[model samples]
Target: MADFVKGLFGGQQPAKVAIPGDDDFADYAGAPEPTPAAISSYTDAAHLAQPTGALTARPYTAWYRVWERTSPEDFKLEMYILPFLFVLILVHVWGTRANRSKAKAWSKAHAPLLQQEFAQVGFREGEATSDDILREKKADEYSTYATGRQNVAFIDFKITLIKRFNPFMLLGEYLIPLFFESIPAPAERVEATAYVFDGNEAKHAPQYGSGDAKKVSNSSFDGFVFAIVHKDIMKRMREDRYDISLTTTRDHAKLPVWTAVMSESAEITDMMLTPELIKAIHDAGDSFEALIVTDQPIDQPKTLDDTKPKKRINLSLKLESTYTATLPLFQLFLRLPDHLATAAHFRPEALRRIKQTRDEQISKIRKLDDDEKAEERKVAADKQKRELRDQKLGRLSAEEQRKFLEKERERDSKKKMKRSTVKG
Candidate 1:
């Protein structure tokens, strides 16, 4: 329309201009279409068959390849097996917990029976009363932990009834030592007797132990007779000191046959019985009998006051029957069967607990002994070193003395370092 308007107004006609790139399109449009064979020749078959970088497997996609490799049969099998395995693990855990609970309950139920067994022996559970005393160094916290701590002492308050003294042994050499051994033996003999049996009965004859045994000894009497008294009465005996002495009578009708001063020892009061005194009593038609006398007078408590004056308890250790006399050796064997019978009834768990407590007590006593021994050794070593130093100083000149002092200081420092290393 613009071109017609321009022609009427005497303007020249506008021509259509062609795009610069349309020449190739006009040529191609006039050309014939290519055949299928020609197109196939231009295409690369290998390039299409081979994987491209974009289509190639990657490290991150390795799991997908693994999934593809798995058989459908294996996947079906796992589906049925996995749940059973999970249930098995749960059952195992539950079974373990149930067993633990059952064991704990059983232990709680039988603990009291085990304690009763301990009482059968001389061990009773209670606080320190007037009857029992604990004479050992202990930590302040120990008292607060348990009342049974006080009753841990080996000695029971009541005197255990020993079998009647054998008339045969009274004439034997063994009787001499019973009184003589009461007086401390020679150092060699005492040391030799440290471990009497070492738990071996066949090699060493059954005899009383000395040094090491004394540390963990729980028996009130030495030799064949080991008497265990009741807990209640033992408590009363510890409240006060009483004189226990052996006396012999010239005649059965005579009064105050034997007389001796009472000397106190570890828990029990003792007096030396001379052979001459024993003979005098035997001549008195008393059959060499020893009478035990205690100054503990018996008195009744009029009031129920806790602050009441202390009363001396009249205690007695009497023979059951003078007629049924047995040798000490035979008496020892007789007690063995009684011990066995008592032990046979104890449950395994209770026995284990008893052994554990006994071991703990032994360990504590042993530790205290070791500490005391160490202190004694240290004191002796210091004295020895001091004496040696004095002798060396007396021989040395001023210059030599100075050097000796320096060397001693170095030696002492090294010794201290060695001790610390050992402790660590």
Candidate 2:
């Protein structure tokens, strides 16, 4: 008990008392060499000491090797690494290809889907389409609308579609939901052309086709030949909360009949059912069943009013300003109507004249360039001809050499045609 109490207070103090007086001093003074640590073999020793077994004195008959199996996390890490490495390769190869990659397939598929959705529920049911998107912009600044769609490509190996501006693009970019009735899938596009119309009517048409890209030859006319596929644009309007209102411009002289017909058209159709038309007649409460809208609201609820002078004046200050700004072009378009009607009838002659004008311009530029080069060569050749005269060889002037080259070119062209026929 005394020893136990001493050991607890100051660890094994008794070991010092057991040491011999001389040997204790020697042991403390002498230093021992550091032995190397044994490497772990995991193999069982001769008298096998199994981790989960009782110790045995008999020698081991066969070696028991322990295999360190891979953990669940190791497999998961490999799974993550392989796909990440594969996708990295695809992006480097596919993104910068000279031609657009297969991502266009999604563009082709989604364009029609968005088109159909926008076409449906787009405008008022019975309204005239003359006032399309452009007119709606004026009615109310707060009015939300489906604009247009654009397609763009971004890097990061992620080729997903993003929709902007137009809601149809949203449908077009991503896939349209399948619940909508089965419309045909959108078709593929082969080519697209921009109708590049500058002020020069003579050089209006420049056709691009499957030819030398750097120098495209002109076709008969400039018409964009994009993929000609059929897609539907549909819309459904809300029968409720619709009102018919007319905003008019008083200047009959300034307004074209077509423009006037379309100007107030969108608002007229914005809500076909006015507030008065949607009467609360439901027996179950203020719910609506049938609605009524009088053409004109008068002193009486049911009666149509015609006497009031409600002359709406849509101001022409801005419109007139724009016309005054481009009065010359506006007059040209006005005068163009009569000639345009005639132009449709004589398209072939117009095309020929336009072509002739373009060819003439190009030929003039070429002639000027060739003339400058010819003059420089002429000065050099005159010196050479004087040298040739000094020599004894039978001499011809530079002009004669030019004539000879032209004759040879013509002869070679004919001979080439003859050889092609023989080969055929």
For each candidate in the order shown, give its overall lDDT on alpha carbons: 0.34, 0.31
| Model 1 poorest ten-residue lDDT run | 186-195
lDDT of 2 by residue, 1-424 (tens): 9878875576453234434667647666433456898966865585365554454456654344223444566689789999987876665444333122233332233234323323321233322232221112211111112211111000001122122233444456345435453442332211111111112223432222224423532222121100101112111111111111212222223222222111122222223212321121111111111111112121212211222122110111111112223223222212221222222222354335434543454566567668888999999999998786556233657787677668879999999999999999
- Against the true structure, whose lDDT is highest? 1
Error of 2 at 307 (Å): 34
For the record, the alpha-carbon RMSD of candidate 2 to the native fold, in angstroms, is 28.3
For residues 1-424, write the lDDT of model 1, one tens digit per residue.
Answer: 9878876675754443556878766545533456575566657887678667757666465566877767778788788889977876676566444433332332233233323322322233452332222211111100001111111211122212111122232245445556874432111000000112212332232222443443442212121111121222222322332222111112222223332222222122211233433343333332212222222222322223321222111112222223122122112221222222222233455345434533554566567678888999999999999998799799999999999889989999999999999999
TM-score for each candidate, following the candidate numbering: 0.21, 0.17
Give the TM-score comparing model 1 with the true structure, all chains together: 0.21
Query: How far off is residue 25 in model 1, in Å?
Result: 99
